[model samples]
Target chain A: MLDQQKVFYGILGLAVLATLGWGMSTAGPAGLAFAGAASFTIGGALMCLWERSIVRSAFSLMATFCGVGVLFILLGADFVGMAQILIYVGGILALLLFGVMLSPPDMTERKLVRVGGGLLTMGLGVAWVAGKVAATVKWAALPIDQLPEPKSHAEEIGVAFIHPEQYVVPFELAAVLLTVALVAAVYIARRKMSDFVPEVASQQENA
Target chain B: MLSNITTTAATTAAAAAPSENVVFHLLAEYVPEGVPGWILPIVTASISVGIVIALISVMAMGFTWLERKVSGHIQCRYGPMYAGGWHGWAQPIADGVKLLMKEDLIPIGADKALFMMAPAIVLGAIFGAFVAMPLAPDFYFADVNLGIFFILGMSSLTTIGVVMAGWSSNSKWSLYGAMREAAQVVAYEIPLGISLLVPLIVAGTFNLREASELQGDFYGMGWFVFKNPFMLPASILFFIAALAETKRAPFDLPEAESELVAGFLTEYSGIRWSFFFMEEYAAMYLMCLVASVFFFGGFESPFTYMAREQFGPNAFITNVVAASTLIVKSIAGIVLMMWVRWTLPRVRIDQVMTIGYKYLTPLALICVLGAACWEAIF
Candidate 1:
């Protein structure tokens, strides 16, 4: 098993490097970085196929998120990239790891169970829709003539949210919705007052 | 037609000047003329990576020695007097050699893949953060407009590594340490980010170099630390939060030595362990450098007039001086951290949470508001 795992990782590493080389040749340095990050994401996702441990899967997911973050940076969406790292890696992944560590020990021993037929069909349907959308969008395939210069779109994004003629209402609505969700989450997570009262009454009766 | 002529003239002038930035000029000199455009950027990136690695290694060695010597002095004793020629200045080198030759041990039942990758992730995150840092006006790898934001984002990546190391170790203590690290980093990040926003609001930019440039006057008094009453408290909050973020003492519950036995690091050894240490010290320096840029006048000299005047003909000297100033300020920040580490007792995990959520967060929020108001009024 150990030797197999090593071989698996070796193949993954080689595949990633090969992709990176291709990216460099096609898109130059920016492309190279993007390719490297993309390879990590892909490799990590592939690892999930063989790894049964929930903790290992969580790590792989984190790697995928990090790769996505790098891809954002390469695309000049600096604000988005930073947000990806902050929210996904720092907040969500940590929370996931906490859940993994705190759960029952038997959880890690479970194998990756195959999905039921219905769920698999639903997944395929969703992918079909995604493919349709993907086909409709035109992706520019520029030649690798020059290195893509890094641009800062942070100010533009900040402005668009509050520009009045742009996405101000949608932005404000998103904030309100997030706030509501947060309150709802907290209310759900908190221990019930009734439960505490019952415990208090039981203690008094026993005394 | 008129615009075309002016554009051409501008291009000619730019070609004549050949960019005074050291990295730009150095790469230009090395890459032969008529090379592909992509080659320059690739070569420059490679050089930057090389420089970053060297910088991290050298600084980590120095910090390890400095940390030991400081602890020793604080405890009233001589530290490693015989490891090297004088006062064991080469103690870190000796330690490095020892660590290299020591047995590389992986605990039984450990998750080998994650265990092996954890240190690399931590080190990579720190290195990524360093790319956006500005040592001097012309000395950064990339001057992204959202440089400070990028650094903050990259620094948060370290938590993932810490968690991976802890979880993969399959040890209870390691798990506890990882959990503590996750909680601490997540909690402290709020205040750290809020404090950072105070300067961001005042400067109206997230670029570290630009922020530093704005305070490049009035000698040291022009620093954001002394910018306004709000900034003073903001700086204090930032410093405290930074201490927690870096997992330094008084907030070092993640690796509380007496309780957790090195925490997430319990299962690591040899070069793997050294990578963690290197990441920590490098991160410490990165945080200090960032704080200096935001709160202090980054690469700006205390002699404001001299700094401004030296830009004419002695530009290279100015760059060197600016870089040195930033380094000195960063070192001072590191020393302050060391002082606090040795001086204070480690806080309980609960206390750490209390400080982060109860005090620092609210105070930092208030400072942000106050800073915004101050900026508007001023």
Candidate 2:
């Protein structure tokens, strides 16, 4: 009754569910439990729904992100919740949409390589071990209620960007990375647009 | 001072305590108090949203009419007339109705879902910026502590939405326009964020109310705009960058009628196009509002404090003067944007890029340094 692949995925799902439940219990009664249950259910369902459609997969990923956002909200981290929505839903989802547009028309016919059964088993086992270790760690023993109210998390982050601790370097690094990406995108777009220029130029000159 | 402390504590206790507590307390003060605690928060939030929406909509409509009149006069034509018994005051309403009644069409090959989502997204992002904007003393939605960052973060959503609309339409012109918009907005955001930093650095807090309050007394132009000489230029630079980012007038490459055949909006018609128009107008007002609040002293009348000193703490007079002055200042900024839009010709796309990256960026960096030095020296 137990196929090896099915058993591996089932164990993985159960581990994620258990960890999520523990987090939800500690997260208080502010819809975090709902978010956790929703995410687990959706993520589990995505495995069954994985098909030839890229849009479907993208939607599933988006659902997972929405759950993460709710969890952030439950933690009373409204700024983080908004950021999660802005970045993942707005930016990453748009990027995925672009990916869908760029993918070959006959996506269903294209043969995609699958991992070996042994590798899958090994990965699942490693994940299981990691989860076990994480579960045993007494994270809840740390104080949480004493945390100061986050009247303005964004303000704190902004100040941290100026102050030389925790975030200044990383903030600069994000800027640099963004600049690099901008340059690369411009270069690629320019190169692509220029490919048909010779014919258009000759026609213009003739006219 | 003694009474002030008691009132503050009472209000705090009122907010935190159960509705029953407040109701009983108020009942003790006057009539039978039996209201619930949660009712207070719900009532406050609802009233806040209602007031904010009402004030913002009225102001936004006025700005729209003013822009049209200004543009029409500049072009040697008559503008709105005979609405609300004056110069065509109700023209925007008529236009809205016309747009609403127009046919909504969807192209066969277009990505229907995103095409619909794009304008909605743009409106949502721009409207969201209003939450942190303060009108008068004790008037704001939410009073977000991280107001500056929240504004920036919310505004950035427009870029994604514009890109989606352009790409989803499956039209060549729209795609090109969207690409240009993305490039332009992203480029300008750097300088915009940098210019904002000059004020943030001076104010030492991202809270808009705190920043405004720190600008010294009312009536004095003791805002960040006047604090350091460099801040004036920095504020101007920020406004220019905002105009470009919002794709207003000379920087409106996304819908440049002369070049790209209406650009990204070529396919959109009727109410959909009006949605884009509302987003643009709203963003223009928001930009001016941010400028006024950050650089100029927000909601501080030029003569309010003088009047207060002379007349002795008349709350009614103080509020009226502050509201009027704030409205006038914000309108002046909006009018200035309109003038620039009508007066200047659209810059070429390449020139636009060059100006934004080459000139604006270096100038913004110089202003940043100048501002820091000004702070140090004086």
Write candidate 2's Cα lDDT for B1-378 as tens digits: 111111111122122212132223333454337764444544554444455556666666677788889999999987888766578989887777788999997778787766887787676566666656666554455556556755676666666667767776778888778777867876688788888888877888766767866764645457788777778888988988989988998899988988888777878889888777777777888888788878888665557566556655436566566656666787888899999999999998999889888988888899889888877887
Best by DockQ: 1
Q: Best TM-score goes to which candidate?
A: 1
DockQ of each candidate, alpha-carbon based: 0.37, 0.15
- CAPRI verdict on model 1? acceptable
Per-residue CA lDDT of candidate 1, range A38-131, in tens?
Answer: 7767776777655656678777887677777766655656578678877888788888888787654433433324435544776898799999
Please give the distance, in angstroms, between residue A178's alpha carbon in candidate 1 and its true position after superposition.
Answer: 2.8
Tell me how many clashing residue pairs each candidate has: 0, 4
The most accurate candidate by lDDT is 1
lDDT of 2 by residue, A1-207 (tens): 565446655776686667656655765322234435354445634542443445435534544654555445344465675576556655666566545643433344423244355457768987999899898988778553232243445666667787886778888999999999989988877857565689987998899
The TM-score values for the models, in the order shown, are: 0.88, 0.73
- Evaluated at residue A169, the lDDT of candidate 2 is 89
